[model samples]
Target: AQSVAQPEDQVNVAEGNPLTVKCTYSVSGNPYLFWYVQYPNRGLQFLLKYITGDNLVKGSYGFEAEFNKSQTSFHLKKPSALVSDSALYFCAVRITGGFKTIFGAGTRLFVKA
Candidate 1:
């Protein structure tokens, strides 16, 4: 079984500050991690993915995440937070050889302007 955990229910950041949303996972095999963002009532949007490559992966909208195998963590980061960046974020783990993808409950980011 594969699962992801986003410890924080909400992360608050002021405009122009750096923000980080933490996540950890448990999987049978190598983990395929992904980050997604959802605005208000919109659908989930793919932000970044950690497939098979460097530990550090960059994604859309100046977002990036580092895959830590030892720690079983993939934390999302943004150098400069924007008011528009405020959204509901999720961390997901793709079952190595299965069709199921488990996602964390979600973390709401509030970027105060």
Candidate 2:
């Protein structure tokens, strides 16, 4: 029983535009999606992972993510966005064999300049 749904809690991009942060998931097998970024107090930062092959997966700094396995969606892309890319974004799902990693209650990105 793995689950994640980040139905936008906050998102406002302006610095350079082109930024999307949204995710949805529910898993039983063949699902190990992940994307994380947190700054304020600093803890989570492992942005980008889909576990298998390119469904458009790239990470670190100039992030990217698009692994839509029939609408199980995993969307988090950044083409040009940096006001230090205002932080706090999380969408994760990894409980396949069980070591639990299910998180999505954060989506705060306000990159203004």
Candidate 3:
């Protein structure tokens, strides 16, 4: 079985400070990792993906994630947060032979002005 866990229910940060939303996963075979962002009543937007190769993957809105195979973790990060960056984030994983993607419960990021 493949699954993802976002340990935090919410994260709060100042508009100019850095922010991180942690995520971990479990899978049977080679894992396809993805990060998505969602606004109120809107569909998720693809932030980034880590299929293979580089451990460090960058994405939209100045966001990036590090793929740690040993730890089975992929944590999203940003150098500086913005008020507009406040939204819901979901981490997902996909294994072979399946069209379904497993998503985390989601984490709400609150960037204060």
Candidate 4:
């Protein structure tokens, strides 16, 4: 069974500072990594993904993620934080040919001005 984990319950950063939401995974084979952000009363929005190719994957809203095979990690990162970026973030993982995607509990990001 594939599983995703977000160790942090919440992350806080000052506006303009960098932010990161940690994610780790356990899978049988190669897996796809995804990051999604959910705003209050809004559906989860796709942020970025790591399918293959480069280790660094970039996605929407100025967000990017790094895929580390050895560490089994795909941590989301943003160089500059914005108050508007505050939201609940989720990390997901899916096997190469699997239909079901495992999602983390979610990490709330707080960008303070």
Candidate 5:
């Protein structure tokens, strides 16, 4: 079984400041982690993924995440946040060779100028 968790329901940050949305996972085998952003009335957009190779994975729109096997975490990060970056974010996990992807409840990000 594989599952993901976003502890915070909302994350608030000032524009131009760094932001992070925490995520942790539990899996029986190797896990595939992913980050996604959702705008109002829009579908979820792929931000980044961690499958293999580098522990630090960069994604679209200046976002990145680090895969930590020891901690069982994959937290999303942005060096500098923009007001436009404010949206609902989700952390997902899928076990190796699994067909289902489990997602967290989601965390709403508010980047204020």
Candidate 6:
């Protein structure tokens, strides 16, 4: 079985500071990883994905993530946080042969100005 855990329910940070949203996963075989952001009443927007190759993958809005295969972790990172960055984030994973994707409960990012 494949699953994702987002330990933090929320992350608070001031604008211009670095921010991180932690994520860990358990899955069978290799996994396809993804990060998505959601605004109020809006569908999730794709932030980044880790299919293969690079361990460090960059995506929209100056966000990036590091895929640690050994630790079964993929943590999202940003050097500078923005007040507009305040939103909900979800970490998701899918097994190689699975059609269904599992998502973490979600982490609410609150960036203060």
Better of 1 and 2 by lDDT: 1
Per-candidate Cα lDDT values, in order, are 0.96, 0.89, 0.96, 0.95, 0.96, 0.97
Per-residue lDDT value at 53 in model 3: 95
The prediction achieving the highest lDDT against the true structure is: 6
**Of models 2 and 6, which has the larger TM-score?**
6
For model 6, the superposed segments whose C-alpha errors exceed 4 Å read none
| Candidate 3 lDDT by residue in tens digits, 1-113 | 88999999999999999999999999999899999999999999999999989999999989999999999999999999999999999999998667789999999999999
Give the runs in model 4 whose Cα sits over 4 Å from its true position: none
lDDT of 4 by residue, 1-113 (tens): 78899999999999999999999999999999999999999999999999999999989989999999999999999999999999999999999988898999999999999
| Model 1 TM-score, all chains together | 0.97
lDDT of 4: 0.95
What are the TM-scores, per candidate, against the unseen true structure?
A: 0.97, 0.33, 0.97, 0.98, 0.98, 0.98
Model 3: how far is 62 from its true place, Å?
0.7
How far residue 108's Cα lies from its native spot in candidate 5, in Å, is: 0.3
Model 2: lowest-lDDT 10 consecutive positions: 93-102
lDDT of 1: 0.96
Question: Per-residue lDDT tens digits of candidate 6, residues 11-113?
Answer: 9999999999999999988999999999999999999999999999999999999999999999999999999999999999999878889999999999999
For every candidate structure, what is the RMSD over all alpha carbons to the true structure, in angstroms? 0.7, 10.7, 0.8, 0.5, 0.6, 0.6
| Candidate 2 clash pair list | none
